[model samples]
Target: MITAIRRMFSSTIGKFLALAFVVLVGVAFALSDVTGNSTFGGIGGANVAKVGSEEIGLGELRDRVRLAYNQARQDQPTLTMAAFVESGGLDRVLDQLIEGMAFEQLATDMGLGVSKRLIDGRIADIPAFAGVSGSFDQTRFQSFLRENGLTEAQLRRDLRQQLLLEQLAGPIASMPRLATGMAQPYAALLLEQRRGQAAFIPASPFAPATDPGDAALQTHLSQNRGKFTIPERRVIQYALFDAASAPVPAVTDAEIARVYKDNASQFAASETRRFAQVIAPDQAAANALAAKVRGGTALAAAAQAAGLAPSMSGELTLSSYAATTSDAAAKTAFAAKRGDVIGPFQTGLGWVVARVEDITARPARSLADATPEIRAELAKNKANEAIVDYYNTIQDAVNSGASIEEIAADRKLALATTPPLLASGRAPGQPGYSLSPELAPLVSQAFQGAAEGEGQLATLVENEKFAIYAVKNIIAAAPPPFAQIRPDLLADWRLAQGQKIARDKARAIAKAVEGGQSLGAAVAAAGPNIGSVQTIGGRRGELGQDGQPVPPEVALLFSMAQNSVKTLEIPGNRGWLVIALADVQRPDPKSIEPARVAAIAQPLAPAFGNELVEQLAAEAKRRIGVTINKKLVDQLRQELTGNAPVAE
Candidate 1:
């Protein structure tokens, strides 16, 4: 549940914008193509390529790498188990670093800027900033920024730049006619898959054969370049410090029980239900139909006359149900019970009437069910949060005029004995957790400072809990043995083969169909069980037999509409499907007529990301200059030990 909520706001657009934020400044910014120059050989010299005249300071490079690492880890959840492994995530961080430098340069040259108000607005809208009750919590928001090594001013500056970059790219990527023309191709594709009958054979019945020819593999590679390459992974040896580092306190059951009673509202209780429904073509039509049923019309008989099927009811819970409906009529229908007939209420499309067969509210979630969370939290409070103390001790020592060594001695925390680790966390000069959120600032300050083996005081931060850190080491990423990736190469090869077959067949069928071949004739000619052509509309989910509605593949089938034929190659674990289209339907704004079936979907995806992208862009554009510490980069490269280049 915790992971889900976080992922909920991370839409594709938000990710794209995040990528843009990194690259916006570098894309058109200064170029460090020191083809034959010597701007880089100063003390400990730059281990990284300079971005124009600015040093791609090691400190900035690492920080950027960390950010990219975090984001990519979240994006590719399937690549790891819970957390990113060194071998898989570091390259992603490096790539992002390179892109950031590139875009920063670009933004700089373009003279882009973002305003404070925009950044503020964006911050205000983030769910992370929301209080427990879903309202804006300035304290929480500020706390998060502080913990993440950011100040409102800095974020605003960065966001401003990000905004400008997005604006610059906006016009170019807008939804032009060419993009919308996707509908034509989409429509014909669906028309090709008309509702038909065929048997579905399970892969369990077949023993697939192996390919013997190198030509087969070569052919596969020739057609599927996308599948054969590595994702350019990096192996950062990061040291983490947070909840995992802070020992979980032993909060008593009594305390947890007391807290639960004190906050009973925190415990959720609801009933799950199964509902069956019958909808009319439109609300008015549904209402009229309902009147007949209410006027002593038999449900089955009336359904027959109205060209509708008798609606059935089933089980659903509060979590699975929403009052707002795809069709206004259906939403209005929700108000009625199975046995009770109700008048149709007006909906966005038209009027609706419904008879709910039954409604049952059963027991839902309880405190006992969620006690582990409560206990962990109470434990933190009871322990006075050692994580917080870890930071406070450092801050107090810094304020009391103590050097990093003294502070370390007082807490029995070893003064960092080695140099800072490489920014990528792939490898490190010192042994300990890397700029792990707990020590992010300390690491930043350490690498940016002039002295080596010296500690630096940093602002307070919060990874899992409020904290601060000291750093004395840096490790850089290193290239891995090609032998380690042999298995990956083999898998890539097989995927390429499947894609090649699908692509080749799909194109061939599309061409033949376009060359005046009738669909029936094509079906007869093809050896495989022919898939039927379906004329699907923008809206889907019209209940099939037994209330089974259209699947997403059905929607993808109708996403385009045109006379010219096209094909969709669906790859599956068992086999691939090549679907060819024959007809299409264009969007008719004035003709959003009845029968434009729409499926009930989750809320038109949470718009949080839409708002996030705009805000992040605005922030990135605000801060125009940063002096990256190149000396740190060299130290980092030497520490980490790989020749992998950082983003320029």
Candidate 2:
């Protein structure tokens, strides 16, 4: 029960809900007046929803929807409140809140309640509320409540409800042990292997006798015009304010020295020691080995006598030692002098006995040695600040109606106009064109059907850089002229002809093999265009020789009776293949390794548990019954999105 409770509170959903509660509390206080008592017709009175007897008030729903809106904006900075609402963000938040209320109601019916002490302990355990002494501070807690606009009573109520929900739901979701019999069949299937013979008839080998004539080409182009139509393209003119191009301020000697002084520990190297260790299964064995080493016996001899392996460690710093061994062992090793025998301390690996062979004390690097790195860091910081200031000035000018080109020329910033190119940033049979990495967002904005003189400021590379671009021209998507695409049309026409020929040849070969001819003999009789027949040992869950999964046709070979030949169409114009099942290999039950089956089953336990929990939750919801006001929901959606309401 304790484990389940801990797991619940540590889960991703739990953490997100906790964070949302904290964030929404602050937002609710600030927006309380704006969201309070808002009604949607007569249906959306004070309550937006009712899960069991618990009512989700209009104010609470608004706060959750607002929080969801803010989170959406973080993922897509250009997303507006209307876009979020239209994307069903409000519905999703309401669903989560309703589910939470259902769980709370279930907990109440179960008589699951948390005491004041438990709530206090939970709050004290939160690291965010801890002081420098690593204990909960009353002042800090009260200050947090004030900042987030949460009263003590409100916070206690929320915490108590959350605990109750966790107590009720945790056990259902806890991982359960799966039996070996449940997983062995799957393991055997995954390990099953088969061998077969396959023949591939490729389309490229069977080319058409001649290219289609001009009239045929015209007909093909008309019939398949959509395939050749180009996507909309745009010609864009953009100006970039790059940090790399910004003037870097010179760093002074005093500045370098100050940095070196402030970060003195970083410049100092840690002391390291070479160690020889003997690991034993228990402390008694480890202690005996240590005593032998201290009494002048060699570590190797002691280990051999104790039936343990002796190993030598390279130069290990205190941090490395703690990582490789245990903190207790590392502390003992570091405090000892050269040739001192230490340990017999317990670690995750085993009980360890170690001897220090050599020690090296590291000295700090001089200021002269660290000057180059410090200078580069300082210069980069200055350049970043300069670029930010430069971008602000350019953005202000652009907003005030001064053209980007004029500002670029005056400020000597990089300004360029791209040739008309498709949305993919390329033109047919031409060198590919691409915007600068820092200005890539300009391409999307440019093709958003902006009018020829319209301009917009878009963030590029996040806060580091931005570009203001204007659409120089728009290229409507349409089929190119027949004469312009004649070569492509001819090639595609021939490929179609070739694919038909290959399919026909494959069918003939399949017929021959079905008539009792060997696969190799059938392919040989089909003319030289049909490629060589290859035999593959197809293993379930293993790739074929071609670095792909054994083709689906070949995989079906295992299910066929011995020597059965089946014809299946291969995808991607690779043509059809006839696979002859030569052998099937099933793993012997008695020879199956229990350890391997257990390894495969380990990851499946949590999935089975989660499935059970979903079923249980669904049943619980059904038993409790849930009623939603469709009119209120529709009205809320219309209000948030400014869409016309649907007639009932």
Candidate 3:
């Protein structure tokens, strides 16, 4: 229980909570309310709530809410306090705190508590409090507490409460017997086999009774305007400044010679060898194989006789071979001449007999042979420097309020403009607007900065490219005219009508089957194009002939009684299916393997424990009687968010 509690507080949630508390402290200091009496000065700064005789202070409540806000911002980066409130983030945080306090109160009533020494151990275990040598350092701990506006006493008190709650809930939640009964029924269902036949009635075979005219199209458009509405788009004018386009100084011969002299070792190659080996399970087997190879039997033939295939060790350096095989094997192979057969040597993987096929010696290259690569590297570096200098000049122009066009003209940079394109890179019904992958970042930046009405410099590729862009025009989202989408509307209307026809046919077939008619006979009576019924059998998770898990419709078949039939709409408007349950073959409970049952129960155990813990906490809350100060909570909410209280 202590380990679990420590892990929870040391994980991401703990880090986020600490950061949020520090942020709250900073905000309080900046607002001149560090003492808690200046901003929320009324009601003598009392506790926000009480669980039995225990009080949850206003400062702690505010910090928890802020922590929730910070955590939520990881998923929704633009989340505002108003949005957070609307999403019920504050209420959730309060409920969590209330539940925790309820557990702590229950623990106190039962005389369960954590010792000061345990609390000290838990604090010392936190890595953030550790020094360079990895043991808890008093100086670092004190410095952290001071910087985060937390006192040692307050931290210890919080840790003790957390530990006590864990002590109260841990045993009740860790009961192993709770999952056994719940897992049995699910395991039986998972292991049950079923056989059934389904026939599909294709929606494509049924056509609409009549075409959708203008009036019908207009009505459809009016009812589903959001579907036809286009997203807001922006037209951007931008310029890319990159190293590839910058002027580079030419590389001199003397400079290439100096670079080659300074980095001579880089141009030297290592000796390597190619070899093949036959591994045996024992020294006797390896010795027999080595004797056969020495007696002029081909290595492959000898390996084949030994019931093992010859394996090749592709060209490898001495160090590389030593890392993979044993140092003894590598040393023997390297010392042997080319085409030499050696090694009945012992290795980490039993024993090996090796034959060297070829060997290559290390060699050094002359300066002339290395000049081309050095000159290219020098040119790249010089071009990068030039680009950086040019960007600084561009930054100066931007600071002076020069327009993109003016900067491009003065600097001779390439400038281009894009047509109004949606953030999804689509114009209308057409596929995405084609743009180079390198320009994606610039496009994203343009959309983000469109509202500001000024050119913004954005990094395109880190250290290689940069772009400056401004919105030339803004196109607001609106629904297309009925005339413009008339064809698409007609096609959609036809598809919907065809689907209804298919559904009606499927429902009739299902009714007939439920009335004791054979599924194959009903499907044949429906039409010749409706494919013949086929039987598929499998356990719940087994894949069918199509290599997909037994379809949901088939799974539903097992849930029904024998001879019962149902109609299901297949996904993607392909068709509707009328399925009849044929047989459900359940395995005998005694015959079910213990390993399979355990596999099914392992993941469910933790979930069942969590549910029990939640129920216990709720019961504890009721027993202790939680009292929340609504007026004070509302005032604190307002002060923290700068928004008026939302009426309950």
CA-lDDT, candidates in order: 0.44, 0.68, 0.69
lDDT (Cα, tens digit) per residue for candidate 2, span 1-648: 012212222343442234324433322221222223544444333676677766666656665575455444333434445656766777766765566666666777888888999988877876545532346857556654553445777666667767876686667656667788887876787688888898877777776768769999999877665457664566788876667656667889999999999999889976989998887998888878888988999999999987888888998889899998778778889999999999888888899898899999978788998899999999877776777666656655755667777877877778788887655456554575554555555665454333476545566665566676788887655678888999988877776667778878778876787788888998998888677888876567455645855657666676787777777766544567767877878796546799988886786676666666556556556766677767666767776654555334
Which 10-residue window of candidate 2 scores lowest in summed lDDT? 1-10
* Residue 321 lDDT (model 3): 87
lDDT per residue for candidate 1 within 214-247, as digits (tens), equals 5554554444433333222222111223444445
Better-scoring candidate (TM-score), 1 or 3: 3
C-alpha lDDT of residue 620 in model 2: 55
| Stretches of model 1 off by over 4 angstroms after superposition | 1-69, 78-156, 159-391, 395-492, 528-556, 571-576, 580-648
| TM-score of each predicted structure versus truth | 0.36, 0.47, 0.47
Error of 1 at 447 (Å): 18
Lowest summed lDDT across 10 adjacent residues in model 3 is found at 25-34
lDDT score at residue 325, model 3, on the 0-100 scale: 77
Per-residue lDDT over 404-470 for candidate 3, one digit per residue giving the tens place of the 0 to 100 score: 8898888787889877766544455546557777877666545433243465566777667888777
* Candidate 2 off by > 4 Å: 1-178, 202-207, 210-212, 222-234, 244-382, 395-403, 406-410, 421-427, 432-479, 508-528, 544-565, 570-574, 588-591, 602-648
